[model samples]
Target: MAMKRNGKSPVSSDTDEKFMFFKDVSLGPHETQLRFRLIHFWEARNPVKKTIIGLEMLLIDEQGTVIQGFIPPGRIKKYLPDLKQGSVYRLNNFYGSKNKPMYRVADHIATVSFTWNSELSVLHEIPTCFDEDRFRFHSYEDFEANCDIKGDLYDVVGHMKLVNGHTLIERPTPDEVKIDTTRHIMVHVQSHDGPVMKLYLWDQAAADFCKKFNSYDNTPTLLLVTAVNTKRLGGTLALTSMSPSRIISTGSAQTRRLLIKQVSADVVTKPWYYIGCSGCHAKATKGATSLVCTNTKCEKINTAGVPQYRAKISVYDNSDQAVFVLLGDAGRVLTGRHASELVSSYFEANGSEGADHLVPVPEALISTIGQTHKFCVKVTQHNFSGDTRAITVTKILSLDTPSPTEASVGNDIAAMSEGATQSGDAVCEPHKGGGVTADEESKRACSSADPETAKRPRCEN
Candidate 1:
């Protein structure tokens, strides 16, 4: 006979079967009953094969002990229809199997696997309370200790210092195109007074972060990520999101700006711009009849090509010196002229040229030398890999106020004057007649003929 608890039918106390806690579960078939709350569940898939391995879950008992649970692909249909995130459930028969060591989300020695005859039912009346959720947060030092170990995955909470090198409050433009094909975002976060650590969010985690970040009127500074894997990149500890990872943001926005003074342009070594796919803004290759995007993930097979700025310049500040690559919108923010407009103006006046036509460094970019300005830069895997010494600048900040690019659309003249502070140097627009002056044409002709410059790999987006 079942007993009533708080006006609801409770598990029958008169039953001969005894209920066991998660801690008591051992490796073998368990005929006894186990009660737990389903904290969360996600599909586990084989990365290489792209096949579903099983449905993985986190379960918590009345004792607040959390354990990993799994339902084989064959039995998923039996239990998935009734599975709810926070619902309390009872399992009659389950197999106790050893938990996999790699990418373990919960600190459990064994996993509860559903058997062919296993029965899952909702608990109408819970006898005891179960914790709603559980989290294991690790400090920077703790993560550093276990870096690249593939041990127990943990959670992290901190104040976001940078998102793709932009401040926490900075938002991307509606039409902004990202060159990174992976769509991953890198964030610098610091917990308390600890050192700053890099967190890379990929795929769904990146989408969730952007959704939560933009939902608020003011940007959220505090960040919390669950089940993150730690890896050492360039000998520095970095945290990365896993398939089961979750992102949470709260608290007020914090701004930390990075400013630098333009020392010189490196146009002698690298071209100032690249032809990119109009669809995805990735570098485009010359196709049989048309240009094609180099990004394998791009949907467009044949796409129109457009010239985009990718200027490399040496920059210095009171602290140190570094090379920064001004790409796409960042170049427009500094020069007040789009790369397409400049390329078109040059070609229209000089006549159509070959694919290797080297557009001279625009006077607009050269005019910014010795000027100090704040910049938004992205730190990519290339930076960690030491493949490139230049950091990609995403946006340029004004000296007096935030650029209209960050606020709303405004007058181009006003935005350029405020956004890019010129050192009393005259800003020269692209020459509409013959593309270049005698002096500038001489410089371009010499650079174009140089075997070394021609041998240097073209700058990729």
Candidate 2:
């Protein structure tokens, strides 16, 4: 009573017909049925037409071979809503073709496109052995070898040693019609005791990463990035996230163990610098009469610059020694004293209105110098002005030496968590008011205080 599309009857899950693996899929006119788990998927919009083009999916069969799946716009109302990521499904009546190398998100050599005659049904009794493939991870050498070939994706896992806040850039999309102007985070990822690679997270992926990173009470020092496109920018190779990319906040078990081992080992640190710009928390330069923010785009002037405490420390393990910079909030966490309070104390110790009117390094912060602490330092290098070498600290984990003033810890904990509570939800701007540009919004975002000296508390709610 039914027509056999491929010179054979449609096979059901209950039947004994051999299961079709993803690798078996080819550019054939015959109907082939398959059951696969949807690993990841995303909706695409026609940039020129401004209409939906159904969705793109990455699926894996029991054999662990990956294949690209597509649903055309005509079938959107029927299949798009029913399809869920990470679910297994039985499908048939799709056509395969050699994938477009220029737009390949997955490494699959073949792609399947759904047609009007395609059929899909949810599969409840999936084989227990069916699991997502552990991707083939590459190293710096592999990156160097393949970076020139564009549109190829790869996997990387590393310790998030350095995390820069955010930078806005305008990028052209695949169509070259619409430009995506968004914020990107520059993260330095290092493999197991190996070389470091630059990773750039743009738009939503960047927001998600920042949220999980700062919001959690105990953030992860390691991360796993899958489906990263290799790009050579400014004479250096970098990893970038595509639409189907996945960023694991809590890195794999192996990486977590490595990070723990690295942190717990005999790591010693000494305080280096004591003051910085209150807004971005960059090292403040000694101006003619006041401190100037090293960040050139700073909205506030040097004289009006709100003074915040920064700590630079020399870190030494058996292997090597490095200098780390800790901004206001992280410094406060380590010393159990707010930067503003320390600055106020400095003003009190020395007469408030000196020729420079600069706040001296507070005793509370100075005591930390030459002392040892266990810090979760993100290792990144910045040479915007010149090729200066130093290790940058992204976050502070713990202090080996107990706080001298134990009572201050209880008082400081509340103030320290105030900013973190909102970090997961908001963008980098902690105290953001309506602003004109992305750069301006970041500048106007609330920190501890206004640049004006009259402002009492350094940070605003």
Say which candidate scores most in TM-score.
Answer: 1
Clashes in model 1: which pairs? none
Give the alpha carbon lDDT tens digit for every residue of 197-307 in model 1. 788998878877777766777656667788999998877678999988877454433121110011123244467887777765656778899887655555778889888
Q: Across residues 230-257, which tens digit of lDDT does each residue of candidate 2 receive?
A: 7887766678877667765544466565
TM-score of each: 0.51, 0.49
Q: What's each prediction's clash count?
A: 0, 9
Q: Rate the local accuracy (lDDT) of all candidates.
A: 0.66, 0.56
**CA deviation > 4 Å runs, candidate 2:** 1-14, 45-54, 165-182, 252-461
